[model samples]
Target chain A: MNDRKTTQDWMKDWQALQRQYWTAWADATRGASGEAPDPATPWHEGLEQWARLFGDASKQSETAERLLATAKNYVALMQSMLAAATGKAAGDAAAPAWTEALRNGLNLPGLDAALHDNPLARMLRELRGPGAQAIDQLSASFAPFLARAREEGLAWLGAPALGYTREHQEHYQKMAAALLDYQDAVNRYNALVLKASRRSFEIFEDKLAERDEPGRRIETLRALYDLWVDAAEEAYAEVALSAEFRKVYGNVVNAQMRVRSQIQQEVERIGVDLGMPTRSELNSVHQRLHELRRTLRRRDDDALVELRRELERLRTEVEALRRRPAQAKPAAARSAARKAVKTGNARK
Target chain B: MGPIHIDPQRAVAELTTFNQKLAAGLKTLRSLDEVDYGATPREAIYREDKLVLYRFRGETSPTAKTPLLIVYALVNRPYMVDLQHDRSLVRNLLARGEDVYLIDWGYPDLSDRYLTLDDYINGYIRRCVEAVAKRCNVEKINLLGICQGGAFSLCYASIHPQTIRNLITMVTPVDFHTPDNMLSHWTRGMDVDLFVDTLGNVPADLMNWCYLTLKPVRLFQQKYVGLVDILDNKEEVENFLRMEKWIFDSPDQAGEAFRQFIKDFYQANKLVNGGLRIGESEVNLRNITMPVLNIFAEQDHLVPPSASRPLQQHIGTQDYTELAFKGGHIGIYVSGRAQREVPAAIHDWLAAR
Candidate 1:
């Protein structure tokens, strides 16, 4: 578990490191708060705010660890269940056929080894590896910038101005705090997904096992195929309906958006320095065009409404003239009759 | 001893047939230059910003006074309703001697990315209804909304109830946040703004991926495995290709509209909750006072019957009728049962109304 090379081991190490970071950060905050540089300006606000973010990150890391552990256990359970069923028929054709079917279903390597070890775990390991790798890359990229900021922040607490005026210092600290919070939310989301996916497959297996009764037994390959679909939908329905899924889903996405927004802000700041138009400017234009189009539509609607009214009025006048000359009905009377006929026909 | 029983002869027979058919199917696939559809004769009577409104002329003439307009969802092309002559809902409606019109919300592009839901429901649909009414010389036209189009039609009827004599919603989700709503669940937390901004118009490939992943083993794997049975039948192969084309022929969703749809409908669940607004007009379900024909597929994974069932409690229409279509979402439009039951039900309902 202490090793940081394998997926689970590395994730566990990351969580522990985050906890240590949070502890160190919190200690700094407490040290800052215990002393006052001048009383006129509170130096601890910036430090303490960032400290809370680190604390949130630590909490999220712990939560994700718990969920991931649950997921790992679930994977182990599925491996055991699958092994129990397949191991009985191992020496026969049925076992080999089932293995072939499973291998095809998984479409992943290490199948032979996975059968002996844990197929579900191997599958999950491969599934999560790429995403984990990408996240690690991004985290590494952000590390240097964060390290510099941390140094600047700690020194500024003891140095002149404490980074800036009260408002600016607070805003910067709050933003840093948010960055940590976002990362935590992402971790929580990732962990939740791992657990949810493992749970989903387990549910599928459970339902498939249930269909082993006499009358409802899966008799054919087609039946097994159908069972897979039924089981998947059933599993999806369960996870989809759960309150935890919804909460974590929202948390993860919102956090990702927040992190993206911060990155976009930095990009915009750099763009502004280079005299380039940012997304905000384009958005403003889009907003204006949207409003203008709506206005044009409203104008068109009004004109159409007015035209209809004018048409009706002209028809009324024409009908009046025709009535004076011949036995033609008045426009009002004719329109009324038409409506009556329409409603009457509908009623039929 | 083995855990299960097997019929070796039956298995061998099936496998042999499957292999032979699969070979024939490849040749048939190569021979198929194009699987053309929309067999029913129609003329584009109106065109607005890539959307063309076609008025269908059926074999039989003028049984129903009001023309029926089919409004299909933007998620996919409308040709699913008119897939082919035998499987076509449009043809079926036509054969029933009903005047029919269809609004083809054509493939949206970069220029159309600015088009919002307001532009779709209020602007495009409203104008199309008016055009159909004028063309038929009637005060109102009958509207049939399929899936998301049904949702749009609901919004339209709410806004201008007078323009639609009858409103039919097929496999439409009225309640967005239902417990079994997988689509809503997945989209509830999505960063729609970022997604839209990044993609401009949502890519069809991505949209297809999202849908296909819902039941990956079934949609992608099992279905292909089952395909072996019908692979030798050229007709069946053609039918399958036509459907496969339609399934993959998803148009890019307009960016602004996609943004609003995901945020307002999927994320907020505003339509069912009485706070949905397209442009400026609030979509109050109470305003849907016209006769409503609500049809839902029994086993639709996309829009569960529970999602459509809430419309019974919400609408102001006392003249509401519900039909339980015994199929999935796609099957309700093309299955043989649908060919017989659906259009007939619609024809009879419209005639009575």
Candidate 2:
């Protein structure tokens, strides 16, 4: 009876605290854009209000975007802990409920169900730092071609072309085939990533079990989040260092390169037809320039070698002159002659 | 009890504080302009193609006669050594009366795609070394190589041992076949020829992506999460931005160099296993008879300590000294502990020699 009363009292207090949290968020947003946040919505959704307030105009949009991206996950984790704490019944095992909360909370709302409970996958997807965007842009440009290639299958790829456009037909077929290969490679890589994510939870539970001791217990949301990160990274490192990952990672890269090579060839052909300088022509020039530079450097090296040899010979003669001090007049005359010859050589 | 004991009221308070800090931090971050690095003043002593040899000017004249030429990895900028006033390796080295010089390998475009590892080791590096030596009126200079540049330096030092007085390699991989070497492991399975032929020049972004993937959870998510703690601190934010700029500001690697490096060092494991050739000259690590100081990070994931610890086995130096830094790869150059320990260790080693 006492336990039931305490549970009721705790529930009332939790509701009151949640209202206070929403009021704080709403007040925070009110000064920015006057959008009062709905208390019914998930706590992390408050960031969207801030995101809109900042818009694309903020100078730190990139940093803000990255922060918001990770913050959303962080906030969701916080919300989960809060919810789990509020719903906890007396005598329940503490770690399991929090662990369960973390697992479910990682699957943030509005994420594709396929990526549910897989935070690593979502993190990887958002990790388009600087130069990475170019690859994504290139992939986006080829989306239509890839889609068509996927839908059409490989039936027509092997069919012999009889017309004058046979070479062109074969090129198209190669491009399509390469595209399919790339997709397959990506799928394999994703499967490995998914495997790592699943293993991370197992690691997290083991890590949590260790924290069950006095003074080691996680007492804050940040500490819990940090622990989870540690678990995820440990699991990831295991997968990344595996031979299977090595082969899969290589295949994805090589497959992408092949697809890119096919595309470049196609682009080159179009460039040649359009009278624009092709990559081949530019490459030839660059190769020649590189060769020329090497040749010039070699020539300079040879000249320096020759000069050093001449200097060594001159030094030997000077040493011989020093030894022939008995014939002082002739040696001095010879030295003078050598100086005159060197001066004449300089003029020449 | 349980693993978690987060009070409900404290959780709400923490979340509210996080939100407030985020708002303030974003505003501060927005108000900030682009961050600048390279704390010490430097004069460009030599320019060859896109490569510039810079000699750093310290407040006091260098007491050391021989200049120390830093050979940085082609994958990133050399400014990392001189990242900031407080966190600079170059500054600390200079303060210790060591003459500091660096090779700034500018961005490589399509025109540079044909440049090979031989071209890098024997061509650009050779000329830079010569320039530093000639300017300093010395026959040989102390060569300090970092990461991939360390590998290049090893090959260069071996091939032309006469030009290096003392060689220092920081977080450099000597044994590429170490089981902990994920980069080498991945490259071992790659068709480097196909990769180079297709890409012309390896995109910096692709390289960064590969590096980030090595520790995705920590690098991508955890790092940003940690950033929230320091968001409100303008000074910390500036420091973070500077480091961020350095991290992503990478050069597109010359394709031919990329191909040869991967094939020879990574796939073949030739640097340690023998039979490595740079250009026409075969690199024999046994030929690096100079006084050697090998500094490697204890927690370095990029170049595992196992990979870096084998310099003594391969090199001909009887005076080989190794310093295991108590940090990760980047920390060896920028961390406060690094600022204190690395330069002092390097200076003391050089002085002893």
Candidate 3:
């Protein structure tokens, strides 16, 4: 990614750019003097005063310089990653020896060497280990319900009076399959999650065992953090990207929705039998009322806006009149004119 | 074990440092006055439902003829741009002499469950834009959108290209089907209707959990650890806590909008594939012929750079400029680099345009 530009070349260019930025910033601020500052706004004026008092110019300069240096470091890190990733550096200045050496063995975010050494991730794994079992137990408890739902759905659909047609049979079969599919999908998703977690633990445990003699598994917080991020991103990406996960997820949701629809239909059917309004009727009413409310809201808002505009215009006019020069010849009759205007038309 | 390869003294020192940091953190938290943010002086221009349109009163008179209207995402508070006194995007723009206006999409509840993308883009955002323009007495306005708000802006701009003079999208996801787009990936197969129906308005906690688990180890764990490292520095600690507050303070999404977005954008990739419709209006990216500035985070996990990078290719705007920021999703807004680089770049670009 770096096109083999050494750290020194990159930092020098970066510093030059930083100097340019400061220069431009200074020039721009200097230019601001030509434009009049608005002090009528208290908060903005306060901010300006506060900034001036705090010597924001000097502080901002210092901040800019520091941030540039940080940016330079970031550039260097990205370069290092690139060099490490490509496994080939045409130039002599490569990533630091340790990073480069570590690069060859690391697959990262999935099966990375660092995943084994991440202490915090390991600790979290240990903490969540028991939760895995709880999920399994919960899934087991939920199974019977799903099975019963599947059976009842199939039996209901297969009833001779409802339909002896081929379409009915197909529908029943599909419903039964979907019900089972929902459970299977949930189990699969859970298993994938478990598998990912297991992978991390296995790597972490094995490393811990191997490095038991060294007792130096985790070198630094940064290292541990890098490892943990990789492990997490990898595990998540694996389960998330897999077709099985995607299909199963869709299946589970579709089945759930289908089941809910069925229940709602049944409820509506019951409601019709009892001569009562169903959810559909209520929903239609809600839709109409919602539309009406929205329309009223829009009209009210427009009216209010117009009123506000008119009020503002009147206020502006009043202010303009207050600042106007005193009237000349007609001023002699001003009192009479005002009284006449307030009451009725003045006599010719 | 060979004289304990790891030095016990080092571990002791680490523990001691941790304790010191914890004590300092507690003291800092106690001393903190109310952390008031969105510090730039602003006046409420318009309000509809929970959405508020605010116009910032800058220190200097606006240099631009047209006002810049910021459309923030619905999922979070819009105060992120105007986050703090020094670290405010609004403040910097205001300082730059740009007339800045932002749409604050307040926390949506169950009442807003029926709010579709059409209502957001066509109704709320459209009305907000019109208000800004009318208030400024301008024919058109500069539009700046952040993340999901950017997407909305794109839709709005496409639908009513006449209203937008210049368009700027920051960390906005355009191509939802990009390989690195994890959110899209997870939602790709989701039964959106079922999901939305089941939870009238998707719970903030569940959504937050999904976001957190994106990089479970880093965002959920490593971030707090990093906070601990900076605990001794009271200012840093405060900043950390402020960000922490912002991170968790997410609003439940309007169900209809979320459903449509996930299904059409994520699942079907209709936005890129040319079948995205908001209400009765068809969203044609080709309709957006305005000068476009697309800024994205290089390290943005939420909306990956690749996801945002494809806009130039899809949009009909010949005057397209892609400014790739070297920071993560949030960092692009609040980072030190963002403070100096992003606002200045935007101001200069807008000024030139």
Candidate 4:
């Protein structure tokens, strides 16, 4: 009996120790890593006291052993749970109904509880809680009603099963009919109004015509004569100004020919007076100009052919004037001219 | 005991023939080089004016069911696919009788500074897709998006699933938090606001410099050193020049688009979380139900394996294949090794489907 009492006492202590170990392990594993526990008052003293109470070397070692054993068992239990849930266990023995009961209690209808017990499914359930069940219930309750309502609503709305509604068609048709009626009414009203207005305007117009008929006739004749005169004057001016008109008139014919001849002679005379060169002369001049340019570019020659030509023309004009003997002065200037010639010869 | 003398006439004849063939081949290559490299064409895919899509009429008759619309990233020219005769991905696809349409994102300018995600995803991309559909006289088109374009394409496909026939994404990043990805680590501490503010549109040169800096020792020193060794051979020289031209050809990313990409996709990880918004529509990955073929380079440094692996898991499509090519990021396009593997895989997959 004493031995039995000792065994019972040891078993009680072992159980208590196991519970404490598991509690600590659970707290350590679940809690944040690298976190300091709450500071005790007089830190070192509190630690000493803690060491004396729970952190005793011998007792701590025993606790660690118990904790490891508890963890092993916990892992084994988890493995067994996973295996059973996945239906990997031997024999046709059904899995424990606790999983189903849990699922049912959570109101997860149509869910496979066995599948839900796995880590991945648990995570999914946490994320979307038995949404399928809720959806299924909603669908089951409302599907038929929704279908019936949709059919009846479609019919009530007057929509074609495959296309748009007759209301749409009728609305457009009514609009078109109304527009056509309005157009017809407007046309009829406009025609009648226009006829009445036209008759009224005709009467007014007749009165106006009666009031101004004589003046109008006189004005018309005056206007006609004025238009004829104006047209005749314009025609006469046009004919007089035209070359054909000049030819027909024959007036100033010799004077115009003489003027033309004089203008041509003046142009030729001016060309000769200016010593305007011929084509070949111009070509030679251009060639001389080019040679001059090339000489200038080379910075060699100073003489320019253009200057020589101008000097030669001037000398020829002077000599010609001299040769003409100044055309002999008039009688009043004969004495002066003779004096000038004597002075010129004396200067020469 | 016999000294062989040179066959001078035969040698000369052979040399002449080789030269003629070489000249002919070069002429053909030059004709094929229609796309202007290095300089961005004044007219690009997303220019403000009318969007003109280039259609390469291949030798084989086109199967007029649905033309494939290839959406390439704005970071580089789309002509990388049509680089040269031997190294051209677009040419290979065309050779296989595939009617391919590419979105040549014209280089964005200052006026495009205000261009945002909505503009690209809803405006430009949607318009391009619609245009392709109209041109092909089909209701839908196959979409193949590369790199950043893949991400944008994914968003577009999610929003407009009805307009897509098949989806192909190459070197696309879906999960931003993948371990061992250098880009992810580098981006984590990046001051994106500072970058966007300082540069407006992130300059292509700066991006290229940073990318090259990732392997600075090899890129700056060894690449040119290797080139010097191959300069004697004419074919090798031409090949080197072509690759160099393709490499330096870069395009500036629009500022607002870059900002949104960094903030939403990179920093916030919004795509994987189903929080990405393309215009007013939510971009849910589960909406991608079309046949998907995801190709990733196993030896890629820029886009690590982890960066692209999650696509297979996240997408809702059952007819999905993950093709792993043992190459770097660029090898998928220009490497001789990929000339057989990548294009063949895509061709076979597309043909089978």
Candidate 5:
């Protein structure tokens, strides 16, 4: 009990010293350059004047209200300091004692009159003749009640302030760092997805020849088709869900869909004969021959000779195909015939 | 020869036959493989190792004091100006007794990738102009530039005003800030450096793709579909093929020159601001004191009227006239409607001067 009393006394002396230092600082900053200090001009009066000159009406009224609240707080702080110094219970002090002292010692009635005389209040009075007086009276009456409430409010909140500061700061820092890390991870994932999507198509193209069997080729083609469709869906999901990537990457997805559609249609049209040569294929071969002839003209003797032989072979094959009856033949039988003819011609 | 009197009906038939034969001859010539740069043509007039200037003489003895020099854009072969007997701007000018000279910008090869503005302006253009002057034995020549070549000619005329007596620009963009021009906006945002670095010279195929994309729906669908209506007419079919050939036969632009053009003209808007520099000399619009004729198509999507309007105000020339025609960019040269109005207007304007 004695130790508690001693701690209270120390707090009282510290608060008094703090008040004196703040009052002196405010005076030095807000001093008149050459005029003598007038006892008639209270500190609040100077504060009101500065607020009127340097601040607008709406803001100045708010400042005035804030200043009144601070004055009430100062009175409560003094009471607490006194309680600490005297080793007296806070509740034992007279009810409304600090409020009454603050009202009388600070010249509250005169200050209230000064606040009404302010430009903003004057304008309100002109705007609403007798209503302004009623408002002023009501506000003056409520000021003490508000100050007491503020004092009690600060006492209630003071216990948790230090704990909240450390806990909230650390939690916020961790959350912020985690959010940044998540963003980096998402970016890397998007890049990998894009690269993997591109490589998937390349892999499909490379493995196309590995599936030489008809059934295997069909299965492989279907898989390739599914891969394209799956890639497009994945790109859409990744790009659409991401806020930063949606706009820039949307066109790439659209282009991929278009190219995929074209490939699908072309693959469907090519169908079972994807590996076999057709009439148009032979025409393309002939077209290449013609192109070579046009390009080389009389020059390139070896190329010309090779092109002439190819042209004669193409002509003979086309004639044979035309002469053949319009009857179905087995693909195996045709292949065997082609092999035998090729070997015989080579031997000859 | 004196005007030969003949029956009106007979004259019409003969003229029609003559036109058909002329068109056939032009078609045959156009079908032949295009002459490569530095390759000798079967027939030639003025030939340098790097460049060639073709002169087609007029039927009438040349009487106009000022010779007209047609500068075609490097994007295409200059044969669009001499497409056929009916649609040929060169033949029309020759018929009007104006001495004509065309600048043929031959196809640039891989070695020509580093060719700079100095090489074009000082070497090819200057030599061509000097040749025209030397051939005419005249101090000044009238310049008519078409499309991109129009812009080049404007810069050339501004830098060398004494050589050009009168300047005519058709469907040329000077102010690139027009909001309606989609091509300008698309190109303004392009990564030109990345594109140029990857491809030594911008491939004509890629350039063609970009142009086609501007109006994909129209170029890919409506154009070919509309051809069905004209397939019955042999004349129309031939004309269609000729135009198609011209449209697709794009030449690759020199890489460095294209880079500078896009940077200096489209993005910076330096040409109109008098901040354009070709080699050591600055191109000043104030230096262009010659009479100017600014022709633009009212319906041109590539080079809108706004792109060509600011030229009249910026140039120091006192005598300036603007002729806005109802057509697209290519229509200014080849459209049947423009053939009568545009060419006649140009002839009258040239004759009056």
Candidate 6:
């Protein structure tokens, strides 16, 4: 009977605490120009409301968007921890229950199911800089071809073809093979990432257990979140710095390049069919231009070197000629030559 | 007892304050204008193709007889040194009455796909050094190389030591096969020919993506999470935005140059093991007999200190000096401590010689 009463009292306190959170969120967003907050919605909705209201299309929009994304995840974490806090006594039942809560918090609603628990994958997906194509986006574009390739075996890939379209058929087979290789590499990379993610959780649990000591306990949502980040980064670095990861990373990059090369070839073919200029044609022109420039530069350099030699030779000759006047003509000879010149002038 | 000890009411209060800060910070972020870099005044002294050599103008006449030519890496823009007024390395160096000149390696397009490392180091850098020396009426000029530029400088100095007075290298990677060098490890297995053949020029975005992946959780997520604390401050937001602009602003590397760099420097470990060539000239670090000052950041992840500390072992300079910085690669240029220490250190070291 006493236990039941205690449960009822805690439940009441939890309800009251939730009401206070909503009230605080409403007040936070009240000044901003957005719709009223729904009490039933997640706490991050308040942030979304503020973002929607103040996030103008400006230069800072990208930064704002990134901040909003991370902030939403952080707010979700806060909400999860608060819920966990009310469900149990403070500093009690923190390991398993809070760990589960933290996991649920990160796997927030409305995220793609693939990225539900894999924050590393999500980070990879969103980590691309401006003007850089996301690898995930590229993979999505090639999904249909990859899927079709998987369904069909490679037995026919090596078969000889004797028809007008034989070359095209062979090219398609090569593209499919490259796609399969790329998929394999991506799978290996993802497996490592998954391992890292699992290890991160184990590390997080251990870290939390360490914090059980007096004065070392995590007392706030931000502190707990930071601890989780530390654990996540530590686990990620261990995996990323491993020799196996280096091989996998290289394989993924090389495979992707091959796949891209094949796609570019196919696109060039299509472009040629449409009577448009192709990458191959442009590359040929660029290569020729580059060669011409190199030749011109080399010639220019050679010419410059020859000119310097000529200039030095002329300088040496001039120095020698100036010395000849001093050496070949003595002072007495100069006087006699002057007198002879004067006499010749008189005769003229 | 368990770990977390969050009081529900206190957590709600914290969240409320966080939301308020976010709201105010967004307003500040919106009100700010586009950030501009390169704080000091500069004049273009020479131009060839897309590359330009600029001589920075200081408040007074430079006291140094020999001009210090900064050979910046081609992977990123050179303006990182002169990013802003307070954080500008160029500005600080100029303030110390040092004549500063920099080589601006302009963005490479598809047409520049065939530009080889020989073209960059021998053709562009050599000419720029000559141009700076000619303009200053000096036979030899001081060389200060930053990051990849430092490697290029080492090669240039090795091949043509007579043209250099004093060589200063900042955060340069000498031994590429160091155990802690992640970038080198990842590139060891890559087929450079295939990479360059497919991508005419390495796009800056791809390079940035690779860099961010080095520490994804911290760089992509936690960094922004920490930004929420400073969002409400306009000054802080501007600082953040300036850094953001510089972080993403990068140049597409010339394909052939990138290929050779990755193959020779990262894969072959030639800078340390010898057998490096720029154009027709062989690069032997032993030929770098000039007074050398090697400055490396201790915490630099891009170019680990382990990779940089091997310089003293490889070079044949009897007057070699090493200065260990207490920061990372970028921080060594832009941090407050850098502003206080780096320019002064370079100036003092150069002044002594």
* Model 1 ranges with Cα > 4 A deviation: A1-219, A251-290, A310-348, B1-3, B7-24, B191-199
lDDT of each: 0.68, 0.87, 0.66, 0.54, 0.56, 0.86
Residue B277, candidate 6: C-alpha displacement in angstroms: 1.8
**Candidate 1 docking band:** incorrect
Better of 1 and 5 by lDDT: 1
The candidate that wins on lDDT is 2
Quote the lDDT for A333 in model 6: 96
TM-score, per-candidate, Cα-based: 0.69, 0.94, 0.65, 0.44, 0.47, 0.93
Best by DockQ: 6
lDDT of each residue in A12-79, candidate 6, tens digit only: 87677667777766665565645555565787776776677645588778888889988988898878
Model 4's CAPRI class is incorrect
Candidate 3: residue pairs that collide: A109-A230, A109-A234
Q: How do the residues A1-348 of candidate 1 rate in per-residue lDDT, one tens digit apiece?
A: 121245555344434433433343334344433432232221223233322333434312332222233322222232222322332322133333443444344432334542332333333343332333454466557667656766676454334335347644554554455456666775665565445455545655565555445565544444544554565555545655577767776675556555555556667777998999887787677678868878998898899889999999999998888767544446668889999999999999
B1-353 in candidate 1: lDDT tens per residue?
33233232332233334334443444444455567888888899999979999988788786888889999999999989888889989898888888889999989876677888988998999999989999889999899999999999999999989898899999999989987888788887678887687556787876776677556445654466555567567788678778887988899899999999898888888888778999889999899899999999998988999899888888999999999999999999999999999999999999898
True-vs-predicted CA distance for residue A138, candidate 3, Å: 8.9
lDDT of 1 at B150: 92
CAPRI classification of candidate 3: incorrect
Q: Compute the DockQ of candidate 1.
A: 0.07
Return the TM-score for chain B, candidate 1.
0.97
- What DockQ would you assign to candidate 6? 0.58
Cα lDDT tens digits, model 2, A57-77, are 666677778788788778888
Over A1-348, each residue of candidate 3 has an lDDT whose tens digit, in order, gives 245767676555444433433333333334332332332221112223223433434412322222232222222323233233233222222223323323322322343343343433332332342323343354457568656766676465445434556654565455445456556765565566656654554443344344334445443324433453465556656666677767765665565556445445556767998999876776557557667877886798789989999999999998887775466346757977889887766453
- As a whole number from 0 to 100, the lDDT of residue A181 in candidate 1 is 61
The interface RMSD values of the models, given in order, are 18.3, 2.5, 16.0, 53.6, 46.9, 2.6
DockQ of each: 0.07, 0.51, 0.07, 0.00, 0.00, 0.58
Candidate 1 vs candidate 6, TM-score winner:
6
RMSD of each: 18.7, 4.6, 18.1, 44.7, 38.1, 3.2
